[model samples]
Each structure stands twice: as structure tokens, then as C-alpha cells.
Target: MSAIALTRRRGRRHSIRRPRTGFLLVLPAALVAVGLFVVPLVLAARMSVSDWPLLGEPSFTGLENYRAIAGNDLVGQALGFTAKYAAVILVVLLAVALGLAMLVRRPRRGVGLLRTAFFLPAAVGLTSAALLFYELYFAGLSPVDDALTGLGLIDRPIDWLGQPGTAFLSVVIMMTWRFAGFYMLILLAGLQSIPDDVYEAARLDGANRWQTLRHVTLPLLRPSLALCTILIITGALLAFEQFYVLTNGGPDNSTVTLVIVIVREAFSFLDLGSAAAISMVVLGGLIVLNVVQLLALRRER
Candidate 1:
């Protein structure tokens, strides 16, 4: 080949090589996602369609596991309970966190210490927190019941885990305690991100405190709101530890969640097929809900 033709070919190869290098650099994370998350989900789907036990050989049953769970009353009830639990915890935790953030966003005396105190529970492991609450809500030594009775809120100690209605509320209280402070930090970050000039202008316009919060504070904190909403929703949807430690799906199964049912199928009953089926359902539900949420938020943007 001619020397000029050789040089042109070399330039072309270099151009191709540089772009391919960038693509190669980006490929690792893509490969990780497909290998770790996507592959397991695909395998779970196949497992859900088969009659597999924990110890036995699998046989393709063609939707039998799905049909079994569909007809299972306990599992259906668990799904409803999980939804209710998520709703209650989401509302309570986010409301309390936002309130706390608004109150403490401005530094006061010992404000840093105070924030740390509020957030201390989040540092504790979730299982430990739940177990602590479990002990407290039991009988005789429970500070929660004692406080309630001391405050004239109740005449006697309430068996929080023994009763269905109270069991659900107890779990909500624990979850709110564990998560509120973490969310408070997130919201305070959002609050602080808003320019002081915005509040200054609002004050100059003779706006009251509520008016400033409604118009200025919340509008600028939309991203934070979206973030907290996603965290609370997803966490609540997969709740297992609190109920597992506190109620164990007791009090006539009122506190049973979908995850608890999945655990029971896989471990207690050795029904891997049904467990995988429920897991797939859960994975799909989360994807669909998050997609819808993202679309709605994008529109607002």
C-alpha cells in the first residue's frame, strides 16, 4: 500500500478506537446491572413458574404457583396489610419529619446536638430498634404504655402486639421513630437550599409565616418531597423486620405483610415456587409504581 493510504487508515483506526474506549468504560456498570439485578429477576420468574421445593428437583408447572397464591386468602390479606402499613407509616413519618425540619432548620442553642439526638435512633440497626420497641410494647416493663397511662391517655396498659388494631399502630410508631430523623435531615437540606432572598422578599411583601412556608418553602422543596416520598413508599412496601420482631403476623394475621408471606412460603413451608412467584409480583409492583411516580413528577417539572 502507498504511504499516504497507510497514514489515512491509521487515522481512521485511531478515531474508531477512541470512541470504542469510551463505550468500553461505560460497559462495566451496564454489565453489572444485567448480571446482578436483571439476571436474578429473570431466574426468579422461571422459578415461579415451576413446582420447585427448597430441597426437591423442580418441575415446570405452568402458572400453578401463581394460581395457588391468587387463591390463598392469607396471602391476599397480607398484601392489603402491607399497603395499609405503608400508607400509615408514610403519612406519619413524612409529616413529623417535615414539621421537625421546619422547626429546627434555623439554628438555635445547641441545635447541632439536638439534631444528633433526634437522629440517634436512625443510627441504631433496624432490627435492634424493632426489638427494643417489642420489649417496650409488651407487658409490665413497657415505657410506652406507662407513659400513655401516666398522661391519662389510657386507664390500663395496652397490649400493643396482642391486639390487631394496636399492633399495626405500634409498628407505625416504631417506624416513624426510626425514620423521621433521617428524613428530617433530608428535608432540612432541601429547606436550606432555598435562597434566603426568597424568604426576605416574602417578608417584605408582608407575608405571614404560614404564607411564606406555603408559597416559598414548599415550592422550592419539590425535589426533596419527591425523594422522601420515594424512600418512604419503597421502605414501607418491603417492611418485614418490625412486624417480624413485634407481631410475627399475629393477632389474627392483621399485621402480615407480603414479605412475611414470602418468607413463610420459602422457609416455613419449603415452597420455593410460591415464594419466587410472590417476589416477582413484588418486584413488578415496585417497578410499575416507581415508573408511574417518575412520570407524574416529570410532568410537574
Candidate 2:
């Protein structure tokens, strides 16, 4: 064979082997996904359509569990509360994260330390953070209440988790603190991706800080904002550990979230079929919401 023909023959042989090699490398992850996610999903779907109790054989029920959800008052209350929490957390988290990202985007003295300090709370386990806050909010143990009392701001210590409004506000504050730094890091990356020339051009056009931010900065940060919004919405909607540890859906069950309701059905009420059905509903809602958000926020092609 000619030298060029020999080279072409070898290239074709390697190209044929590449796909096999790639599939071999990906096999482990594919198997893991099938085992962990696909299997459990199939089982949940089966349970959702059956009368599955914690201790009894599962019998097919044909959508009875789903029908039961419509008349369940607790499910309605939990859905409303979960929606309200997601909205509030989405707004607050984005605002706080954007502010932090802007503050740390431009480096100066002690900027790294400031970034670490802001992100430290994110490293703490959610349950641990909730426990810490629970103690801090307790009347006699709370330094906040003590300080307010010492300053004569109130006649008595405020019950942070003992009222519906205060309990909701407290959870919101904890969630924001826990996640603001993580989202800040995301936004900071987006901010840094924006070319400095864009800002300089805006400045040359006599744009002030506010005008530059509104027109130049925000438009460029849409991808990061969308990511943060999606994450915040998902986390808030599926919230469990913090509320479970802190309030236990207390203060007249005002803070009960959808996930909590599902757990209550499965464990507290020993109705696995109902819990599976609720989980399927939550899963469907999440898929729909995420799709809508992605469509809305996707950049024009």
C-alpha cells in the first residue's frame, strides 16, 4: 500500500475502536443510574397505583391514592405553604446572592476572607444549622432576645418559632443564610465572565452606576440568575430537614411543607401508597415548573 493509504487504514481502525472504548468507560455510570434512580422510580410508580401499606401486601387500587389527595386538607395546606415559601426564598436568595456577588466580584484587600466568611454557613449540614438556630431562637437561651430585653425593646422575650408569622420568617432567614454564599459564587462567576470592555463602553456613554448595572450587568448575568432561581425554587419546594429539626411543622402546622406531608403519610400514618402518590405529584409539578423556567429564561437563539 502507498504510505498515505496505510495511514488512512490505521485511522479508520482507531475510529472504529473509539466508540467501544467510550462505551466501556461510561458503563459504570449508566449501571449506577439504572440501579439507583430508574429502579426506585419504577417502584414508586408501582406503589402510587396500589394500596401499599407499610406492613402488608400491595394491592392494585387504580388511582384511588391520587383521588384521595384532592380531598386531603393537609395536602392543600402544605401545598399553599410550600408555594409561599418557594416564592419568598426565591426573591430573597437572588437579591442577597446578587449583592454578595457584586461586593466580592472585584477583588481588593481581605476580599478572599470575606468570600470565605460568607460561604462558611453553606458548609454546615442543614440539620446542624437548624439545630443551632433552634437553640438560638429559644427564649431564655437566645442572645437576641436577651439583647433586645436589655435594650428595653420589648417587655418580654419573643417566641421566634412559637407563632406562625415568626416561624415562617425564621425559616426563610435560615435558608437564605445557608444558601446565599453558594449562589453568590455562581453569580460571581457570571459577573467575571462579562468582559470589562462592556463596562468601559457603558461608562464612555456617560452611564452612571445604576444605569450600567440595569442595562449592562443584569442583561449579561441572565444565565447565572436563571440557574440560581431554579436551584432556589427546587430547594425551597422540597424543603424538609431544617423545618423538621427546627419547628417540626409546629405553631399550628403553619410551616408544614409538601415533603413533610409526604413523610407524614408514609411513616406517621403508615400509608405507603398515599405517600408514593404524593411524591409522584410533587415530581410532576417539579418537572413542569423546571421546564417552564428553562423555557422562559433560555436565551433567544
Candidate 3:
């Protein structure tokens, strides 16, 4: 009787394990993510607390780096600039993309060609896009000076990157040109997913197109909009290549992003400790921002 019971139990266990092949298939991916991503991030956290140089054993410094950065004026200014940049870019990207998506949401003449043209720039890498913008704006391809001069809009040709305010605006424009289409794609997908029944109901209720959008469409698109916002905000905060390639943080450190500052500290000055400290702070901020966004999304849901 005991042997028979054991055999039955063994058969049950085999049956249970047999169809878990899909889970087994994912185990390698899980292992690779843990080994490569999780481990390195954990190592970075550990390094954040110590005085680690590129050439020597890291010393146990216990919050010294954090403390130093806390009082540093440059760090504070960089943080302020990063926040400002993120805010400006977020607003512009979301607003423009939403408008574009709404305008081109439906099938229209030449829409396929228009979308292809718009999305092409996003396919270009950040550095390449920035370089292209730099050449365009500086080398007369941007049409800023030409447009102004052609319409008699200005008395003289203006150098967009020669000053702080205009330099910042130039970067924003470059970002907008390259990224608005990407956000448009996300929002456009959300728009396409919305059922026509909802619109018909709105129409039956005497709602105009604007009314339909406000009452039915925008609500359904909340998730995709949130995703775009988070991505744009995060990417803008980490902005480096654009400023580096185009402005080189020039015109009096106007476009000097925090990441650019970190690179200078680490690679240029060979100050690994401060650089690591900056990265640690950046990581902490990103984690906090992501947590806040997640909670807000959960609340909305």
C-alpha cells in the first residue's frame, strides 16, 4: 500500500512539472538580468558610500560623499537646472505631441508619408540628432537666421547658442523636433484603441468633436499619456548628449547638464569619488520619481 501511494505521488509531481516548460524557458533571461543588471546596480549602491578611486581600494567613508555634495553650490545649481530643463521639455513634448496625435489620428491623405517623415528623426541616435541640429542651426540649415532675414524679422543674424537663454531654447527645439513624433506615436496608439461606439454615443448626445475628445477620448488615453510624461521627464533629466554635442555646455555653462558635469568630474578631472557621488544622487532621485509616478498611477487606476 505504501509503495502504491509513493508511485501515485511521483506521477502527480511529474505531471505538474511537465507543462511548466514556458517558465523554464524564461529562467535563463531571469538569471541574466539578475547577474548583469541587478548585481551591478547593487555594486553601485555599495560604491556610493565609499571613497572609491579608479586605481585604489575604496575606503569606507559612510556618507561623506553625500555630505560634501549637499553643501556644494555647483551641485545645487545643476539640480535646479536639471529640474527646470525637465519641466520645460516635458510640457512642450506632451502638449505638442498630443496636438499632433489628435490632428493625425485618423486616416488622411498622405498621412502615412507624414508619419514616416516625423518618426524618422527619432530613429536617429541622440548624439547624431544633436550633431545634426548643431550643424543645422549653426551652418544655416536651421532657417532661424534665414527665416528672420527673409521676412525682415530681424536686423541681424542671431547666433542661437551664443547666449544662455537662446542656447537653452535651441536645445529644447532640437529635443522637440526629434521626440514629439515619438510621443505622438504612443498617444496615437491610445487614440486608435478607443472604440467608435463611445464617439457615436457622444454624438447622439449632441456632443461636438471637442466635446467627444474631452468627455471620451482624453480619459481613455490617460495611461499612455502618463507613460510618455514619465519617459520624457526621465530622459530630459538625464540629458547630456544634446548639450554636449551641440553646445558643449558653452556660452558660460548654460547647457551644462548634471550628467555632463559628472562626466567631467570622473573622466576629465579623474575625480572618481565625486563622480560616483553624483551618480548615486541621480539614481536616488530617479527611484523616488518613479515610485511617485507608480503610486499616482495606482491611485488613478
Spell out the clash pairs found in candidate 2: none
Error of 3 at 292 (Å): 1.2
What's the distance in Å from true for residue 243, model 3? 1.5
Q: For residues 1-301, could you state the per-residue lDDT of candidate 3 as single tens digits?
A: 6999878878885555565797799999999999999998887777778887777788888888778888877777778888899999999999899998987888989999888887788999988999888877787654667788889988778888888898899899999999989999999999999988888888999999888878788899999989998999899889899988888887887678899888887788776777888898898899999999999999999
Instruction: Give the poorly placed runs of model 2, Cα more than 4 Å off.
Output: 1-22, 139-141, 150-152, 299-301
Backbone clash count, each prediction separately: 0, 0, 0
What's the lDDT for residue 271 in model 1? 90
Clashing residue pairs found in predicted model 1: none
lDDT of 2 by residue, 75-169 (tens): 99999999999899999999999999999988799999999999999999999888888877774356777788999998787888999999888
Best by lDDT: 2
TM-score for every candidate vs. truth?
Answer: 0.86, 0.91, 0.85
Residues 97-210 of candidate 1 have per-residue lDDT tens digits of 999898789988988997998899999999999999887777535686679899999998877788998888888888888989999999999999998998999999999999
Worst 10 residues of 1 by lDDT: 136-145
Candidate no. 2 TM-score:
0.91
Measured with C-alpha atoms, the lDDT of residue 156 in candidate 2 is 85
